[model samples]
Target: MRAFTALINPIAGGGRATRHWAPVAARLATAGADVRVELTRSGEHARQEAQAAAGAGRVVIAVGGDGLVRDVAGGVVPGGGLMGIVPAGRGNDLALALRLPADPDSLAELLLGAEPRTIDAIEADRGTPGSQGTAAGGVIVPGNVYAGIDSVASEIINASRWLPALVAYRLAPVRAIAGWHPPVFTLTLDGVTSTLRAHTVVVGNSGRYGHGLHIVPPALVDDGLLHVMTVGAGPRRAVISFLRQAGHGGHVHRPEVEIRTAREVTIAADRPLPVGADGDGLGRLPITVRIRPGALRLIAPPPEAHAT
Candidate 1:
């Protein structure tokens, strides 16, 4: 443990990061961390800053939300640096899933006593299969899931009165009829093939989903496996049923829904599709995701997290 730096994303949580800084910084400092704050200017800026300081022997505290935490924790992964997260965003999906306290006081105590442990992560490759950023990158693209992509389930949980996220999902059209239809793709897990014209496909290194939806409840961040979840195809009735199941966090049991706990996953699509990485969308599809177990040293939550 060295100095404490808070990489705050002001836009997160309707400006939670901006408003709560005074109290959070005061608490962390009072807790004996030589606290400093850094506000993000744009996408990936937080990541760049955290990555640059990965090896500097400091515990970078990513404040904002899950997206911000992912961006910051991302930097320390490749080089094995210690990282912690403060839940200031709307979802705080990771914190919720990990059972960390949502309040600042509990989080500060957790950060101070948290032991460093390796967490699981994924490597996604596209096009002709070159390399995904880090964590794991030794495999090649597997199937026809790359080109055309769509995300089946999202816990985006953003507040939109016009079309609230959960409602929109609860009532998704058979196919995206706005003329934005996702191509049918192929996913292969352990040499088993499944065909699907789906709502979306999410590749996970960590088990957290949009908001707090644990799409893959059995997924462990240190398990060295990619938990792949895809919503099934069909008409609105079926999609609605699938939506119902997704809400339960056990959508995998649905015949239409496909879940795979695998070390390597190959996805192929008709067109180059976009993939969401920890809520931040990135790259075209035809990405190969593989797991790197215990690759990054994450500051643990309190022991209650283990109880959870």
Candidate 2:
């Protein structure tokens, strides 16, 4: 018999995940599926739990937001186990990109019938600058890898107490850009190295991030490549305008913006800059990103099929 295990983040979406899981699990139970649910207390906890669940031949489902999904992917990717997502977080870009449903019945139906799709993943190495020794390991980025001003916005969103998630998400970037300055970014892609000043740099396997912003509409998850997007240094107002256009995927036409693809990418800054992967912080810059072909097996609808 097939078993299902859900690794949920209790505080995701401000504790809504706990409430959300009840009906989903009940539906699965009513359907006579073997199901187990585990609530996460911390990042390490989620990783450990997801690992064990996968080892048991259960279809590991992430029942929280992006951070939970990131940690869960960190565990699932190592064994190349099958994984699924239930978007119950602040930013559900991965879910949006994959077109996963959130409702209980629909999710249960999909989980039972959906086939796993093999997809590439970004492996990121965060190492000290000028270090000769290679790092032992790196984080598995199942979605996008971003840094600079967007990370500042993420930090603001994480710290804000006055605004709801949806509102804070929209307002945070405006607030962050006001005091944010572009960093001198050094990038090496597929053996070529160059330096430029940019407001933000994002490498995506899927085109969406920052709550549905189509920052790289050309990105495709199954492709054995990464999209490298650079927003060249400009006035703060111009940068803000660019981001606003990005929400609709119209920023790529700008002269300062460049979108391209590569198999491997390395990034560093003159000073430390906050980094984010799949909507969660992954510490500082000086990181190397490479694509692992067919690294993840995702239980999502066929790529050509329209979302339900």
Candidate 3:
């Protein structure tokens, strides 16, 4: 039997994580897994517990949203430990990208049987002091790191936690776009610098954000490179259209959208812009983001099962 530690965020997904734990635990018990449960008090607490559990040779399973998964990865990655996931939070984008099963039975089965695969992670340095999202001047991003309109939407989503996920995610962007202004952004990709007036800049590893928008459609978690996307300044209608097409990854074809691949990217705006990673705020730019290829060892569905 494999030893497992479930680090749960009870409040994630508006308390959905707490609700999902019972069936998952029962299934794990039936599978004869050596399992332990730890309800996380905060992001830092989750990271600490995951690190301790990983150090003790347990497969640390994050039973929450992408933010919790990112927190757990911060601990598991540095120690080279194995990790698993159960999608129990709003915008479980990492789990979605990995094609993790949502039903408890299949999820438990995957946890018990899937092989650990090496995947890439983003290491973002905010270059200043921050909260739970940053440690030692940086944060581990399991998905994409972004700023501008999307970051404002993230703020709205975070504040509107009482609303349903669908409502919050859908309405937040509209609210953000209404008040947003195009900012002058300076981007340095692998040491090549350029300036542009854009609505947002995204550096992606897993490529999905804003509840399944393919902000960087060509990004792959194990690609050993970062996909940098810039959404150029445009009319509100054009920006809205871009976001709509992003759900199907059609936004990449737009002339206003630019995609580039690099191992490292540095972003600086004319003024400080809010930056977000894995659906949580990570302070403001200028921030430096780099791809840490194969830094995360995740137990996920086989490559053939991955969603396109």
Best by TM-score: 3
lDDT (C-alpha) at residue 9 in model 1? 91
Please give, for residues 1-308, the per-residue lDDT of candidate 1 as tens digits.
Answer: 45776789987877767665666667778877777778988655776677666767677877887667767765666545778777777657676655667666777777777666656656555444333244343221111121222242222223232454345434333333334565687887767887788756766655565555566666666656777777655554554455456556767777766666777777777766666566555555666667666666767653234334
List, residue by residue over 197-226, the lDDT tens digit for candidate 2.
998899999778887889898888887999
- The 10-residue segment with the lowest total lDDT in model 1: 140-149
TM-score of each: 0.80, 0.93, 0.95
lDDT of 2: 0.83
Runs with alpha carbons beyond 4 Å of true place in candidate 1: 127-182, 190-194, 302-308
Each model's total of backbone clashes: 21, 0, 0
Model 3 worst lDDT run, 10 consecutive residues = 128-137
Residue pairs in clash, model 2: none
lDDT measured at residue 129 in model 3 versus the true structure, 0 to 100: 57
Off by over 4 Å in 2: 128-136, 305-308
lDDT string for model 3 (249-290, tens) is 998989989999999999999988899989888888899988
